[model samples]
Target: MKYSARLRLLAVQTGLIASLGLGFATLAYSETILTVALAANPQMQTAAKLIGNFEKKYPDIKVRFQTLPENQLRPAVLKDVATKSGQYDVVMIGAYEVPLWAQKGWIVDLSQYAKADTAWNEGDLLRPIRNLVSYKGNLFATPFYGSSSFMFYRKDLFAKAGLTMPETPTWNQVAQFAAKLDDKKAGVSGICLRGVPGWGQNLASLTTVINTFGGRWFDQKWQPALSEPESKAAINFYVNLIRQHGQPDAAKDGWQECLQLFSQGHAAMWYDDTVFAGPVLDQAGPGVKDNVGFAMAPVKATKASGWLWAWGLSIPTTSKNRDAAWKLISWLTSQEYIKLAGEKAGWGQVPPGSRTSTYQIPEYKKAVASFGDLTLQSINSADPLRPTIEPVPYSGVQYVDIPEFEQIGDFTSQQISGAISGQVTVDEAINASQKKMTDIMQDAGYIK
Candidate 1:
């Protein structure tokens, strides 16, 4: 062969080697992005920590989170799931939607994945939260955090007012305390409660009040009971309490609004989800962290009146990347992730009320010593199966398990909000709610 021909062949081989090397580099760096829709709350901050660690571990998989307020998050995620739009790979849902969505085939059943992975330790989940996220013995979602309602008040204010909060306060006692502590001249409302009109907003807290007042949404035969004496009394009590002592524009206030009020020293007392305690204590602002005190949710006829809830992660059936989504879900809810989050965000910010292991962690226990036991007690004591004073058909502390209850509860909340705003009398609100509930139940074939 000629010298020039040999040189040409060598150059061609070198070019081919360079092209192959570039191809392999592209393959190694290829990325798969997962979109997660989350509620804008403190839990999301913990999730962000987990996601950061997850990305480091799985470099090829990127995560993007869309955080929306609770009310908006529900409709946005539900619309995507119902329409099979595949817009979100993972969605944050509550106990209320898990069973219904699983039954309707809108979300993936996580039982198989959970069972197959011994390291996942499904048994570590608290029973009530575990059962709430399961349908027909199959898990549909994994709880990121579980919660129950409790009364949070300012120790400083109570001391200044010469008041002492009981471990388990009654509604009457709460009213008395509120009256004494109400000092509007100093820019503080006596109490703050959610009044936003949504099933999961105002009604979540209000339903517990109804239950403690010996009110049931329906009778044993699934009859509408909204206008019954107990229900009416509960509604009237809630309206009057908020109207007289709650924050200004109380009817428009929900969890976030009331949280701000209490944290900013504008409200002396608040009754809502226990999850808020972490943010209230940890936030970098003029929050009443050191002076905050917690007690069981106020009761009337019942011994324990707290409502149980969990914010969980579910993969919609429309997800094109179920396996990757499941991987992210597993990582976020795993004991390992909890530890990682604790390390990164501090034990106080570690997602609580989900795993038994979290409560067992010495650091977490020490960090949340003030509210840990109380929160766990509240969660364990909540009897969703027998939420109200009287026996009812459904099983949920703050919500009825049936799908129709969402619509019914939302409608009732609107009426109650109207009453709070003085747009309608309490009697008129209760009567309208009762009529609407009757129509809904009858149309759903629950009533004769």
Candidate 2:
């Protein structure tokens, strides 16, 4: 061979070798990206902030979050998972969705994964929450945080008004208190309650009111009962209470908006999830932390009225990264992550209501000294099985457990929101909702 030809061949070989080396380098550094869909809430936001630790610990994996509002998150996740689209590796869901999705086999079972991970301490999880996200004895999701509904009032406002808040207040007493404390001229509403139209929004609080007022969604024979006298009375009271004394644009407000109004001192009282305690105390305006007082959900016919809920992370069966998803979930829901959140996000802001050990953490205990035990008590006391005073063929507190309930609740919320906004009367809303629910029940074969 010619000397020049030999030199050219050697040059080509070197270039090819360099190209091969570059490809190997790229492979070594490439990360497995995990797309996660999360509900937009303060607790979830805090988790997002602390997620940097997870990526740092697992350098080979990267997480991308798609945070969406409560109403939008549900449908987006449902559409993706139901279609078996591999759009997300992990999704944030609630106790309401867990069992239904698990039974349908749309979400991967985490029981074996959790069992194999002894360090994950599945037993440490709160029993109500654990059972809530399980189906047929299999753990399908692990709770990031759990909550039960309750009331939070401003101690200063109550004192100034010459009123006292009972540890377990009655709805009638709350109404009387609201009448006295309403100071719209001072830029404060008497109370803040969700009025936005969504199953998880206004209806959540409204359903509890209905339950406490001796109403059920259905009678023992599976007949629509929203038009019943008790249910209608509950609806009237709820709509009138908010219309008379709730925050401005009450019809537009949901849990997040109410949280803001109360935390910023724009509202004197709030009735919603216990999870609000974390953000209200640690991240709210000055003076909120010192003045906020907790109370059980106000009751009338029942002894307890709180509703059980838990926001958890689930691995979809459609995910190609199931193992990686479990690893991230196990870590995110682990005791270590809870401690990390306390250290990094301030102890008052750590995730609550998921684990027994979370309460045992000294910093967490001190941070939420006023409301921690009450949160646990509320969660434990909620009885989904017997939520209503009358016998019902469904199981749930703030919601009905069937898949059809979502559509039914959404339609009812729209009608109820119209009443709240004065576009319709309470009776009109109730009648329309009753008719709608009846049609839905008959269509779903729940009633014939």
Candidate 3:
């Protein structure tokens, strides 16, 4: 039934009065609650500890932490983001998400927040970090832990084989050493690489390998390059190397498994993210702490094709409490928190790659010993846009930046994994990957 004008006016007045009362109740009863989405990595541990300090400073605010495996975190966060469910005030992001999601307006821009807030020293962050966490020149996120890929081996194994890791090694040398160190009879596999399928999981490592072998994912005109000589050679090399000397459960190996293999002294070498240094150096977590060795990722035509990734903190546009979220984010990612983490934990636990200052710290310098210099050098040496000796159309070293990349990467990885498992030939894997990629590219309108 339609209301008379007089009745509508009464209804409006009543509703206005009720809404005002509800708003007052909301203001009175709302506890400053912030939920954060975290990744399963060392830097996340540091961030969690810093949250304690932030809580102490602002007791009224209650912060909740949600940590997921690295592979699951991004997808979960993105789902919430796309739906505007507002489950997360802060979501940990990577280099891949910073620009793409920000462009889509899913995350808040922090340029004004940084500039207006005198307490936060945005300029104090390392330049690489500043750029990595930005989208279209606006700050989109905060770096939790930054990383580049490197080779971590067992020193004892190398010594037993009469071999030593070089500051900068080559793929040929690495393969030879991997062969010599392979002792399946002793339960020690030669090399443990991330092989289980995901964009940032195995494909990230493999992309660098392909790049160093002079591969480009696309031509300037956006043609798929998976079937090219560079990618084919790189895929064949990676598949064969892992199949012959990598972990027995190579099909199941991701970053965590590979790290476990190396940290447990079951693998001779683990080529993965530099952030892994923190856990590997932890004596409590694994048995082979003292026996571990570090080196830059092995090269071919390129001196540095190692991947660059930063697990960062970003506020979503859907958040109702922007100021409260920023307060927590600022404190957790501040310089003091970084220092505190180093002191409370170990110097090795400090977040690396994000700050040049970390390298300058005496404690970290002493702790990392051989690895610090190589890690820093690798981080500095990498130029993601031009990762290989040849130029590529992509902006990422280990990834292509299109919206379709995650699906494409996971699918390509499964195909390549079939080759590694002897279910398909390398040539067959490449052909399948090429066809899938082309179809995706065409559907996404990347190519005609």
Candidate 4:
């Protein structure tokens, strides 16, 4: 890709023109290059095609995608933007970062970019998705993939067990159903959950579980709420469930691990990101493509509960090539990308849980069957602000939207994961989380 003259000038001002030129030259022959930080996933094919098209149109500009492991992508981008390195022209981000980064003025504001580009079709994006991708009524990011939590099960096993999952199953009901379907003697575990210890990893599912069990992380006064009776009950319930029925190495399993297990017919049920359905249904990936089943996440004492997340692209304010990044971001998120994904990778492998239009498409509907509607419903029902039945000040369902939340949530999950690993008791885990959260709250001046 060819750099704009203005970009070269801006790079000179930043004393990065030499570095940028070296970076471009270092790549396979290119005078212009856009560096993108991303997370690897199956749907990236569409973006690759769009990049190919971009190179074809702007032959002078070459886009280099530096895709990281799912967990590493965000932190790498955060470091780049936070340090004002501008190493990344485009960054993959999420709901957790959109508002926070935009509010901090670390990322470029894309409101004008969206408004001026008729071809981008901001209105054509899914409503909840578009909303989650925004901060202060301005678009800061474009969703590359969005998801809500859901249940992936085995229909054949459910039928043989003479059980049917409810439209909105409860956590208790899920436990019972999983027990029935579990065939430990045959090596199948009752349920699968993410145990990977990032705040957005296990904590995503764990927070929703906490909410459904009538728990809150903080009260209106910002005091730590993890010690509440309901929260304790929730923690005990989860710790016991995993100890009693979860797969071995429960603390090591993340989305991919659970997806692999379920697809291999080792898990009776899995509670994870709805995005997992794509690989499960892909004929080339998991061998159990035809036998997979899906439903909305189980809840308790709540109308609905599911965590919302999006893997998206945001330009850092430090970027000198905002317009060029906008071009790439717009193309990646356009309706055209979805269509291309469907045509090239099959409807089942297309990105899920972001758009209303995908479900309406006959090919996609037929490819996905009943669960497509459930995925859409799950995304729509996720109310981050009203996540739990109880009132809370946070604006995220599975996540609390504070800068400190990442550290707090991850540290807290470590405490719980220790219990699941039999290194601590459930009570000890809860008490530790309570103490740490209390300290964090006090330090943040949320408590005295």
Candidate 5:
């Protein structure tokens, strides 16, 4: 009955197996794989978590993230982009790089993509943040989140000490408060600040201080000003404040270390990025969540003293997967993504300062009640174009917008960090940096 029947059945089974294998291969081949470089911050971490939703929505596109700490992320992406290596289809960059990269044609104009995608709601972005990420009105990148510097103080500690913290304390007052609140015996420092050396690390905080003290990186004439009286005063005050009453090993502390210290109740106050308010008041465990106070960035001579910044996503000109990259970017930066983040992670953890609509969400406003209004206020007040009280040729608060600033800020931060570590005096550090700046400015033709 069935030798021929058995042979026919075996052939049918073999064909079925081959058909299934071919179908799986076709699926794999059709799916687009995008390599994205991301900064290893909390929001970006949440983005990595939520990326699965994007993959689910577009089953044909797969995203692979290469996340690194802020210090490492900058150089790795810069090297790849500068060499046109095409290793990364997308990279996380800051507002500082946006204009320069756009001008150089290193990154492609994203305006067309944003224009085509009407659902993305490009106009919903905050005006200040939108301007910062654009060059000559052409968008080269989209901000994942925007931030400005502000102060965080422990209200319980302030009350216990019978001290009334002002809504906008001056730097001098902050120093006095630090002196009073500093309790070394109880394992608490008065304040926590970034001391780790990097352009975006310690220098970011220090630059704002310099600005408030009525100092500019360069005068209108483009002369070096690091060793000028106002600049020196700012540097000395910062270095002295940290050495005297800042967290121990202050020289070794960056934003992450400082956040850890403040969140662990080891510091009475912290002056840092407004983004930290979320982690401080709600997300970063239970340190001072119930007793934190929000205030404007401590001021000196200027009416305000905060720096504006944003971490953004951009496509390099060399990227082959531009469409796929833009798909990922639009998805991450859209209002829908913000809502998705608020739902999946806490509303407190949603990326902030980018969209006007983010603040309007009822849940988000409630979740960040302590800092929401003030965060928006601070971001709006920050003027990167007119960063310093005195006129200067540059247009950055935490950084300069030139390509050489990477080298300049890094070098200057190292010298100032030496002052913080006691390896060099304030005068020595400033003098060395001023000399270096003079040479750089002259060589770059900013000065004769």
Candidate 6:
């Protein structure tokens, strides 16, 4: 009986030890998953590549990316943060949203992270982009890529047509060039432009056109100006140009679509973010890379015509994994990562306009020598404080900075898109946009 009891005790102890070992193993191997929400753009391609390196470096953290279109990303992220849903740990947002969202207590103040890290090199960031993403001297986000608008054209097509493009073309001159270059039967459109009905899609480029035409979103008194003569004329010119010379189904095209069209030789000219110069110049792509030319964004009434913008990463206040999120943001935006991307993805693909050091890279300078100077000039000259020819009550080149501007810009873009599709007259669209802006401003107490 004593021997049998000893065997029973030994068996029980072994079983307990085995169970405890299994539990400890599970705890040790389990990883923390970080969910990131980002826009589906070419920059995200570089980000995806870096993520492999990130995971290799930090094996305990797993990342899952939620990529959405530009039009869809803003609403999805806004809903997630506004409701404190905690669905996204990291979000890619624009400079326009950083200050506004920070003010609403939706995003964490990233100054802490910047200050805590000795190697972050916060001063390396371009001053204009840094200021745009900061609120009252506190950093709210880290810019991944920054850009200003410029014009891209086919040098071969210009040569064949016996036409010469100017260094700074006017909108009127662009229209004349478009009329001469348009060849519908040859499977080419004269120009490509964003026509998608979203504030950040079509209105991003359109707002700059409005500014260059001497139109402001709101007057000094915060009164809506869409129905004013200058605003109406700008809208008319844009809609007519696209309808006459732009690609088929132009009303549905946004940045991605326009990029594809221009890259594939379906369009003779494109006016968009300068960051696209890389993709357009990519040797691996089916683009007119060898014959592409650059010029300043077309202007009418103002010399400072380009619009400034930055796509950045931020951690929401509701994030459960703030530490890991900051780690990812810092790594992706670091000078080291820029060098990695240049070496791996080619020097032309490095994200520009964010770091002054990027321009100093010898390889990058040689790679982008064709248009680097022009890109820097455009970015440096864009003054958001005085974006429009007339004085305005806002501080953005392609957008109004207030929170209410999102809703107003969205509603107004839908109306303007209707004009592009011929479903509504330009006058009708402008009137509707004006009324909506007035209502929003009045309700927000920006106007009585």
TM per candidate: 0.94, 0.96, 0.91, 0.90, 0.94, 0.95
Residue pairs with backbone overlap in model 3 = none
Better of 2 and 4 by TM-score: 2
TM-score of 6: 0.95
Cα deviation of 159 in candidate 3 (Å)? Answer: 1.6
In terms of TM-score, which candidate is stronger, 3 or 6? 6
Question: Tens digits of per-residue lDDT for model 1 on 1-448?
Answer: 5999999999999999999999999988998899999998876867875686799898889999998988789989989999999999999999999999998999999999999888989989999889888899889999988999999999988998889999999999998888888899999999999988999988998899999999988889999887889987888899999999888998899998988888888888999999888877875245477899999999999999999999899999999988889889999999998888788887767777899989888888888989999999999999999998788988898899998988888898999899999999999988888899888889989987
lDDT of 3 at 215: 83
> Residue 320: error of model 4 in Å?
1.7
Query: What would the per-residue lDDT of candidate 2 be over residues 51-79, giving only the tens digit for each residue?
Result: 88999999999999999999999999999
By TM-score, the best candidate is 2
Q: Model 6: which ten-residue window has the lowest total lDDT? A: 280-289
Q: On lDDT, who's better, 1 or 5? A: 5
lDDT of 5 by residue, 1-448 (tens): 5999999999999999999999999977797889999998888998999999999998999999999999999999989998999999999999988888888788989999999999998999999998888999988898999999999999999999999889889999999999999999999899999999999999999999999999878888888788778988999999999999999988889988888888889999999999988866654447477888889999899988889999889999999989999999999999989999999988877999999999899999888888888898899889888888888888898888877788889999999889999999999998888888888888999887
Residue 21, candidate 5: how far off, in angstroms?
A: 10
Question: What lDDT score is found at residue 174 in candidate 1?
Answer: 93
Lowest lDDT sum, 10 consecutive residues, model 2, at 280-289
lDDT over C-alpha atoms for residue 156 of model 5: 92
The root-mean-square deviation over C-alpha atoms between each candidate and the true structure, in angstroms, is: 2.4, 1.8, 6.0, 7.9, 3.5, 1.9
- 2 versus 6: better lDDT goes to: 2
- Candidates in order have lDDT scores of 0.90, 0.91, 0.83, 0.81, 0.90, 0.90
Candidate 6 lDDT, 1-448, residue by residue in tens: 9999999999999999999999999999998898999898887777886788888988988999999988889999999999999999899999899999999999999998999986879999999889888999999999998899999999999999999999999999999999999999998999999888888888988999999999888999999988778887889999999999988888899988888888888888999999999877883244487888999999999886999999999999999899989988898898988998999888877989899999999999999998999998998989998998788878999999999989988898898789888999989998888888888889889886
